[model samples]
Target: MNAPLDGVVVLDLTRALSGPYCTMLLADLGADVIKVESPAGDSSRRTGPFPQDDAEHLYGGYFQSVNRNKRSVVVDFRSPEGIAAVRRLAAGADVLIENFRAGVMDRMGLSYESLQRDNPRLVYGALRGFGDPRTGASPHVDRPAFDVVVQAMGGLMGITGPPHLPTKVGPGIGDLFPASLLAVGVLAALTDRERTGRGRFVDVAMYDAIVSLCERVVYQHSYNQAVPTGDGNDHPLLCPFGLYRTADGWVTIAAPRDHQWQALAKTLGRPGLGDDPRFATNNARVVVRDQVRAVIEDWTSALPTAEVVDALSAQVPCGPVNSAADIYADPHLRIRDMLVELEQPGSADPVTVAGQPIKFAGAETRAYRRAPLLGEHTAEVLGADAPPTTDR
Candidate 1:
């Protein structure tokens, strides 16, 4: 089936996570995402959770997950011809994406300003540590950054994990969040182009995106004159809305609403506790957060996660704290088509990656395609006249 972005051509100059992820979403919808890799290929190629049997090390899960549904052409940027070939590709492309530091592309002569002159409607998408100077100046523009740095500086780590510990989130949300926003920005620019007939530059900073993700911090500080810190599995304003220990494992519970709280109180065999002024309203419960936690755990700690979920699933929002294994075993993900299987080079059977979450009603979603091998599409894309290697 023809997808929404079938004819859109995207020049993917991103490496690692952010840029590739942005293009990966586009490719999943049928965009022709041409990933231009360096001589060494994307560093993530070696960053893996690789198959134990694959001694040659091929590519790892990190690269495969985000780079799926795109084409790869290894290019050696060291060669002037390679750089020019990329510029030529940019001149005719609909979109160009990169997650380099602000000035990296400009130094390579593939700056948005020059490329836009050739393809006036090209949507220039950049995901950077700070931001592109075209949009705004940053003091740390020259500094390199990664997930940990952004998570810390953006106030995410400050409010994440336990108090005073400031732990990094398990997943690279600092990268992924900016990438997702850049995809939205690129689409918005494409939409605007339909009217103006000109594409605009789209910039998303990792730091800025993470800050936006923690928007609750802004209002809490302003409204309550409070400095938010990690509350240890509990919410600051909402009471009894956090994780509790179960006999087997942990289960998350959120019963902040009055009726839900009352139901929870009744389920715990203390219906009178729901009516107590100290715990009647959500506001009151917040004032006695520890008491609420102690009360909930008193009942939950005796039950297994599954039993707790079964009891509270209907009236209260609750579920087990799932691990990767639990997620794979879940029937809900299978029913929703959230797990997809595709070929693995050395594995005996196909391996699974996440399925596209964006769905179209009544339309058959595209099947998952494995990520391209390095330079796999070089011959097919560039043909006989293709620059003799080095489009890095």
Candidate 2:
């Protein structure tokens, strides 16, 4: 039952996805994450894939997915008393995470400088569109940003889809990636505090994180004078390292190395293709990527997805392109505990959310509790003596 962050208390003043995701990871690792929400509650509470029968429409899957294993304490941030209550929570917390605009926390008089005075060892983390002025200032610091904005601006969208048709990625990596980096930064800051006995401000910008995620584009542009553009599913550097069409569905195949390429050629009953002058080396294959793709698809298009996987998976990296339904039915993911079932707040039916990816050797890292209802823990956390506050 003992987890890595067993004794750590996190005052989570984040809404939507980014900050909540960071705190969710901490909460999964056994941190006492107290989510401080405004009276209206997190915006995600209303956004949902709601059950058809639930007329009252409690919290939706979007809210539940990232807010699990945490306690919620709703406070009216505009009220002086509510601010005092947050200060009390922050004073007793080991970490405070927020994803509001740069000056929002400072205007509320709850900046890291103000909180660290009460708890010198507190790790203050901020996830923002640009970055906090305390770390570095930018012209776009005040502009609001979303997943699409950062994905487009950070070069991910540019290299995502087919040529001349850039596409946004399916997942919200713009926000989630920054959140992940902030979590690591918070832990690193906490580690440093053990020696220096001082906490520090950690900031992760959505734009910065996306740029870091697309690190390859930077080096390639510099070294080759190549502005990376979308190349469909095929990798620019490696031939036959992309999705291929099977008879029934699509499957990804990655066999760029010589031995793997030879094995793939042999498996497809085309061993001579591996030694052919135009397809012999990886560079040659890349130079003639369309021909390589045609050759591979020519073999795969005759077989079902399962058959293709069975034929090449043992020898090369290959997998079917799984949809949500496919993932739900996948025996491998089920055995690995990647799909977890949790009870809905109001409905009798249980919903399945993603399980923790980081597996500890002996520690419990699963989602132990459902997402809390709005203001569910306000009284328990603030104590009976605390002043009454609006829970809108």
Candidate 3:
């Protein structure tokens, strides 16, 4: 099926996690994303969890996973000729994105003002730690940031992890969220440009995005003067909305609603407890959450995790704790096309990466294109004037 962004062109000057991830999404949706790298290539190409049997390490998992479905063109934009080539590309591009600290692009002579002069309908998207000064002034505008830094400073860590010791999340939510937001911004700008005949500058700050993700922190403090802190595995407001220990492993169950509680009570073979005064209403149960935990665990602690899930599963919102191996073994992934296989650059065997979650009903875009090697498309994309491939 033809993708929605079939004819769009994107000039990707960003590297590392956040920027590359945003471009990857656009490419997955069928945008012609041209990843422009420096002489040494994107720094992420060096990060590897390579296959043991591979002889020639073309690139690592970290880079391949995020850079798939795009063409790579290495250009040493530091040289005048290289920057001119990139500028020529910008003149005909639909969107240009970057994650450099503010002022770096201006210094390189490819600022929004310079590029938009050629293409008035060009969407310029900037994803940064503190954001560009052109959009808003930030004290930390010049400072660089990564996933852990934003997670800590953006109120997420304040209300995550154990009570006193705030911990970073397992995935790179800081980078991913801001990247997703930037992708949204690019799409929105493109939509607006169609009507207004002018493209706008889109900016997303990592710190701001993280803080917005934890809106509970804002409402709790504003509405009740409650500066929220991480409450461990238990949800502070919803009783029985947390992890529980099963006989063999753990399962998460959320039965906070009255009907769900009743169903759970019946499932646990304690039907009368559904209407018991102490645990009847949600507010009442919150007050005696410990007793609620004991009641559920008393039933669950005897059953294996699989048995517990089978018993409470569809009736109550419950699921077993899953690991990477569990996800690999789950048939739901294969059925849904949520796991995609790609050629491992150097290994004989292929590798698997998580597939795009966004689905366009009729447009079946399950194209699992392998990521391009550094300057792999330089000759084909840039034509005869292109520098020798060995130069990269």
TM-score of each: 0.97, 0.97, 0.97
Per-residue lDDT for 1-392 in model 1, tens only? Answer: 57899999999999998888889999988899999987788999998787777776668888888888899987778778788889888888999999888888888888898999999999999999999888899888888889889999998999988887888888989998999999999999999999999989999999999999999988889998887898778898898899999998999999999999999999999999889998999999999898998999999999989999999999999999989999999998998888988776666667788888888777776777889888999888777646767332
lDDT of each candidate versus the true structure? 0.89, 0.91, 0.91
Give the alpha carbon lDDT tens digit for every residue of 1-392 in model 3. 78889899999999999999999999999899999988789989988989899878778899989999999998877787788888988888999999998999999999999899888999999999999998899999999999999999999887788897898898999999999999999999999999999888999999999998998888888999998888888888998899999999899999999999999999999999899999998888989999999999999999999999998888899998999999989999887888899988889898888899888777654668898998888877788766533343
- Compared with the true structure, the alpha-carbon lDDT of candidate 1 equals 0.89
List model 2 lDDT by residue over 68-161, tens digit each: 9999998889888889989999999999999999999999999888999999999999999999998899899999899999999999999999
Worst 10 residues of 2 by lDDT: 383-392
Clashing pairs for model 3 are none
Q: What lDDT would candidate 3 get against the real structure?
A: 0.91
Error of 3 at 320 (Å): 0.6
Determine the backbone clash count of candidate 3. 0
Where does candidate 1 stray beyond 4 Å? 390-392
lDDT of 2: 0.91
Q: How far does residue 37 in candidate 3 sit from its true spot (Å)? A: 0.2
